[model samples]
Target: MPRRPFSPARNVKTREASQALPPLPLQDASAAIAQSKYFLPGEDLDGLRRRLARTLAAVEAQPQRWEEAFYHALHYAFPGGRIMANAGAESFKANVSTINCTVSRTLDDSMAGIMEAAREAALTLKAGCGIGYDFTTLRPQGAHVAGAGATTSGPLPFMDVFDAICRTVSSAGGRRGAQMGCLEISHPDIESFVTAKREAGRLRAFNLSVLVTDAFVQAVLDDTDWPLVFPAFRHEIGAVPTIWRRWPARDALHTVNERGETCCRVYRTLRARALWDLIMRSTYAYSDPGFILIDACNRMNPLWFSEDIRATNPCGEQPLPPHGACLLGSVNLAAFVRKPFTAQAHFDFEHYAKVVRVFARLLDNVCEISGLPLPEQRAEIARKRRHGMGYFGLGSSLTMLGHVYGDTPSLAFTTAVTQTLALENWRAALAIAREKGPAPALREDIELTPRHLAQNPALARDGHKAGERLPARLLHARYAPHLQAIATLDAALIDDLAQVGARYTHATSIAPTGTMAASVGNNASNGIEPSFAHSYVRNMIVPGEKAKRAVRMESYELLAYRALVDANVDAERLPRAFAAAGEIAPQAHIAVQAAAQAWIDSSISKTINVPSDIGFDAFKDLYLHAVAQGLKGCTTFRFNPEVHQGVLVREADLAATTYEFQLADGSRVQLPGDALVEYEGGRYSAANLYDALKEGFYGKL
Candidate 1:
């Protein structure tokens, strides 16, 4: 029999479903408030929501109207972490950017240029924004350095400076600065960069990724020799730090000289498959240096002509250009699912679409109101107006709807949801443009847009590029009827958009959410990710225990326990539909993320969890499969003895061993891990949020 397609009501008559979902218990609610710190015990949540709305809406011409709209949308509640933490809070509020991250262009290859870039990065980091940089601009090893009168040390050493700066400044400004570093696959020093994180405590503040190319993937598949090339002609015997090495890599027909150097200046060569294997092995074992499809990012970017997206913000979402900051928000999908787990289960479409459109306006207001750190970033904001509005609690939402995450029905449902939103997101941008004017960069000129450039292949190659006709993430999305009410308007707006453009450059993305939702928004699932476990231990740092004991944490799903009990369901049990991260297949995981990615204009931060016991060959196939699946980037995690921490822990694994630790009062207690460590009153990470929850020292339920 054919399964029923999801049909959300066009107009949600009541929030009876949301009211039915269990309210956060007192202890959990206390912990969540303690984590968010936006409201005090006696204060109503609406008070904080009102303050946030007033502050953000103040940017609009008519603040009061938008303020009410903002508060209404606040019911959906998935604003970015920075906004929740700082918005309208007198204690930490400022002209500071509420955006969580930015990627800075290291201006030049010289020491002065790098230092200048570092200074810029420091300023951005100090403003509570994480940063990213592509180290590809640095000269390869053995390059002459006239200033130092020595061969260049390569990009890795320079990255150490950024790393040190990050560590020093991470917690300096009441926020931890997250950093992401990227190097290209064809770079000569790529080997060193790949193995960088193998050392314990090395580059502790930075996440690394290799900017992979289509050529490299094809080369690996064909088992061809891939030459690592740099600008050989641009270098002199002792000249140091030259920005442009006026040399090009050899074409296929180019021949090698007698000395074995290609005329186009190949630095070194290796079998593509060998390099591919190393990356896979490192990812499988050490869990650093993920892959980013550089071409794919630029190819689909809304402002491709204006910038190059070489790196992403720390979380691998928001693939951005230099001087770009991440202004993000998410809609809580779990909140929208009605009659959860029953045959009558469905999403509240009217509410969802209304929330998306209203949130879109809210992000546009953020672009105006927040004081971004850099002049370049400010200019980017004024001209492009990028915002990463996305969704969280996808896994929980699917489970609530009785669909297993990574299953076909769930895939279709999410596709429909995202598709509906993608159109609405653009429509929102267009609606804003109608009043505020399209971003300065957006133009009707065929010469500038990717759509037009595609018509002329040669000019399209370098001059100007077009944005996606159909974003990769939504290539398969289909919306419900309420969205259809806007679909015609959406279509009209898009048709006008090709000529008039949008207020924002890029609109939709899937963020990591990073406990913003977990603690702040009633413990919603992480953005577009599944639950880590049915129940697991989370390390909660208590007072005066910066180095001692931990309070345990529990899953939000447990909130439904009381309701489950009333429904004659097992409160302690997880259903078959509750597909935790580690148990799901990697392919299934990627498939789910890819389905969401199709509609997203920016990127999605989702970790595909691979079982530690999986063989190397199967593990390696994961990355290849990600590429085939058309993912913008691929990040995978497996629990190895080397990196013992993980995001989700199986309940059985918690019972694997008894770990003993000293309490603050000098008393000792035995817990669930192989070893015990002091719990500081801050964020915990074995390396990832998923890992943190899965394998942290203690968990309270």
Candidate 2:
């Protein structure tokens, strides 16, 4: 019987209009498919099917008890979104969504509508979605409160209330709710804002960052004083009129330090170089306290003509104004990698670009399809229609290219790749603009320019030259205008090559790639991390197992595979291989991240792998050097065998060790041996085989 080709109800265009664009040379389809087996989910239908089958098996094994477990598993698998077979799981995923809220307006302006907003947040959190808020609007401490009693409680007090709501509502079992809180440099309470998370265990549910403006940065660079002011507001309390308190002169010094309590310490002598140093120090010490460039963010803002942006989402991916939600997605770059050494081993850039374009549209739709927690959030989304499009498997892609990360060559390669990606993204965005109309905020006056226009007559003619007299016709076309069309890009993109600078508010972000990478069957160091060693054991908790059990290399037999791939060793049989930071030079790892960072508009989240033997001085030097190289930030983890826990042993250390295992035929197997292997340093190994033998034949004895 002939099979009917599967077709989607809507034929979304996945390619550019021009067929003249070159196609990726086709390699052996079978070989590509074979290699793709490891790639997983890169191809379309079959990959989705495989995912469904695995999910079903996991669910059917525990029918009633597996709902929560399955939800998280599926969420991790499809971070963007997914269609599920089980209505229950689908509902669960749908409920566990993302929401953005505005908190930058004065309490009277913001809170008047906040109770209802908080209620929305509470409901969303209760249902399992993460929330993000821009806290730059609340008046600084000592500022008068208008509505209630005309008294002052400040942003912190309000945040405390929000914290309580988040904690209470996001406590659903197996559902972890998260929050992102941000403040601006100009805020009167910048000192408290900078160190809000300094106390350990505080803000357990939230991530924090400071929104720095170009003016603030320039002030730091110029060693000039910066001001912290608050807008005056009127409110009635107990039938008495009250006015918001104003600081006569709030200097940068006051914002950083107050009366020697470490309230804030502003260094007037702080040069841009010095401030940059401080930021790097803080980031390296505590991963909190990231920077958000305000001027750049606003200059390119499409809504520059309308609204102002203050903070970003939790992961620092989207720089949204108050109540703005960004629909996010990433294309798996490794999926586009072709195999073999000939010209045929080329990447399918055109197809990948097409997919990205569709993904962009899908993300936009997500904004419309998703339910908002506040009216402000819904209103903002409709006004801006923002989305975050990024990439995953960057490290894997670099490895496949045979480029050692952290090296000069790798850095150069990364720059080229980023440029290519930026250009493609621009083309896609432009096409979308033509189809759906440019975002309401997009400036009609912006123009495209070339990098070396000054030296090139042709470019000059196209309005790309610097200091060149423009002809009447070119002037009329309004070509070669400022790139600061999008608010977010104005702060991030340093070099302006394409006139498409502010094409979209924010075009890049790096997320924690752990779960998504895992579902794709890749070692999970998504955008900015090195593979954390090839074979580290994962500790798992099983019923009746007094202690957590460890599972080592369960799939692909990594150790064996590594040995097989080693050119120096025997090719016929696999050997035992353990990959450490040293296996692939540390420099190479750094280079790979640097490469990816080149293309990213925002910073990358990466931890450099250092060998234990490296001295503390060396570590400090490494970090300092990274900062000098213009890298946004760097974290390092040195391997210490002294801290290593030996292999697994016994479950008796934990007390009890008995459990039941389900069989394929709707049956159960009872196990009565140690289920956990205990080792020093709080590590454990699974004694499943031993337990299964005692339990009976149905177990994997």
Candidate 3:
């Protein structure tokens, strides 16, 4: 296959169509943040856009024309912060990755393997990549370590080691190092992992999640007993009562089941509902340890035959296998609405599809310059060529069109948008594959086995026989379940994909673009979420600062409505369509996520916000509802001032809350959280200052 020549003739119409709707003007804070964070020395936002455009356009034959098109695309859809900061930044002498997410290689249950994993993680973080690791492979606490002739301290201690490493290593480009730590539902130490974060200041650098299985969910529903287990070693196989299950490791000694599960020995059994209550209680109190549907993620994985995913990146969006990596970008949905907030307001699907197509190619080019730190990580990305290109500002866009978030019309609109994005991205994939070849994973030879047929009976229904060798692309295009969603939309496209394949294995994942939205998106709703509040203060992590600085911000739609509809509109008195996160029903959020998940190849990073006073049983049921809705994961936040403060805080919530600030002499000064306090020639909000002192970052400033 030969690389395609760059041609901007087709995109001319797209450019002209979008010209009628120019990019939203950046706000004051947005401009300053963009300049200080993303802009290179002596460069403004426009110059930075041009630099990225030129760098990404290098993949095309006519770099100059494609560069211009890419520059225009940046106004509507931009890459993640790391990409914006590192792309074409070699001249600045920074050795950092443009990729955003990566997972550590499968860790072995030994000291040597654990140390090696830590070393690799340190390097990966230093190179500016957020990494995830599953800690279930290690033996349970009190388990004998024959090599050391003593009991092991278990995975929690190992997590502390990694947490220290993360705190010590300053990620490239001055970003705080990020990490994800996951444990299996059946791990013996699951209870400890669930409650670890509640101990304040422990594992602060990591986002924790539980890898939940379908069997576990069913057990909870059926009120059955759940066994906590670990893999049985060859020496202990006959000594212990063993059960067959699907495990992350592929060791030779483990006995395999018909469906490819491994033999494991049960350490103990607990009432399923009891454990569920424990998880739900902790999540309700502290909002830590989100849970991922492990089985669903693997079942829908495009490369199901090659990889097993046990963890996700820091945000729980991109669930990756060991050593896997992915870059991220999102289209600005707010930019596509024409005549916003008017009777004639509508999203331009035609223009939106064009941007998706162009963005598909742009993100693919990023793989060539990923600059991943570890060889295994680079090799994994090269084999799969995965990237997550989703959209931001869904809530804002829906509101702009006079539709409330999570209503029937809103769900319908979300489905249409997501379906269009999926279809167009696949169309671009086929074109790119024909031009520059499919991902290596797609071209590899794979043998269809009973395990494959068991995992997906569609393979057998499509006439794929067991023990037959076939191209991986055929398996993916013709038999993969996710692609079938669009089979009716364009049957010919699906047929063509069977023969032509795609440039990347996975294409779409929504991300929680907190900073990206605030800076570049003019404070649009964070990915697939309703506005947190109309007016709020965001605590931003400034480099070299002791504590996060508070910046007041407004939702993009609110700003647009005031400017385009009514300049004097009161923030408190809004139209019927304006629904904030706290105002929307929990079920509504699940409905919207379920609608979008149908078309998204990868998972979504969405948080359902519930009122702090919501009942305990109702909060616990949200997870069950999310699982029933077929979401890959579920995360929710109920603000607890005593536990922790979030990045986004509503003014009213702060005003209603109080913080007690104690001086060095033992006298305590109590003030409302929103009150400004002067300390050492600096002004800080009482809440922000309290958090800084409690979290131990105030001294650093």
Which candidate has the highest lDDT of all? 3
TM-score for all models, in order of appearance: 0.83, 0.58, 0.95
- Which is superior by lDDT, 1 or 3? 3
Q: Which ten residues in a row have the lowest lDDT in candidate 3?
A: 2-11
Q: Give the per-residue lDDT of model 3 (tens digit) for 379-443.
A: 99999999899989899988878788888999999999999988998999999999999998998
- Writing each residue's lDDT as its tens digit, candidate 2 over 1-701 gives 12122121111123112212122222232123223222232434244434433443342334334333333233222324222211124433454333322232222324655565567667756644456666655666765544566655567666667777776664443333567676666566666665655554356567666666656656754767565545432222323322232222232322322221113222122244444455444444444556655555544343443345565555555556555666555555655555411122335666565555444543444444445555666666665566556666554444433443455654675665554555455455565555555454443332323322421244556445444443322221122222222223333332332223223544555555443443443443354544444434433333333343454422111222232223232222211112223344555555665566555554455556655455554545564455334444445544321122112222232123344556669898654433343323333333433332332211111
Ranked by TM-score, the better of candidates 2 and 3 is 3
Off by over 4 Å in 3: 1-24, 171-173, 251-259
Candidate rank order under TM-score: 3, 1, 2
Taken over the whole model, the C-alpha lDDT of each candidate is 0.69, 0.44, 0.86
- In candidate 2, position 311 carries an lDDT of 58
> What are the per-residue Cα lDDT tens digits for candidate 1 across 1-701?
12233223421223334434655543463355345344533556666678789988998889999999999888786577777666766455665567786888744667888999999988887777888898887778887665687898899889889988876775445444689999889788999999988866567678899999888989999999987765544333134222222121332333444333433356778999999889988998988879899878876675554455778899988888878876889888877876765557788888888889999999888777656778899887777788888888888788777787889998998888888778788878778888988777664332235433542354445443444342311211111112223345455655566555677777888888746555655555688878776455544334322321223444454455335422343424455666577768889989998888778778889888788789999998888888998899999888664455543455455456454445679997765552443344444322332234433323311
Query: Candidate 2, which segments miss by more than 4 Å at Cα?
Result: 1-117, 124-128, 142-153, 186-188, 219-284, 300-307, 340-351, 361-368, 430-508, 537-701
Top candidate by TM-score: 3
- Displacement of residue 482 (Cα, Å) in model 1 is 22
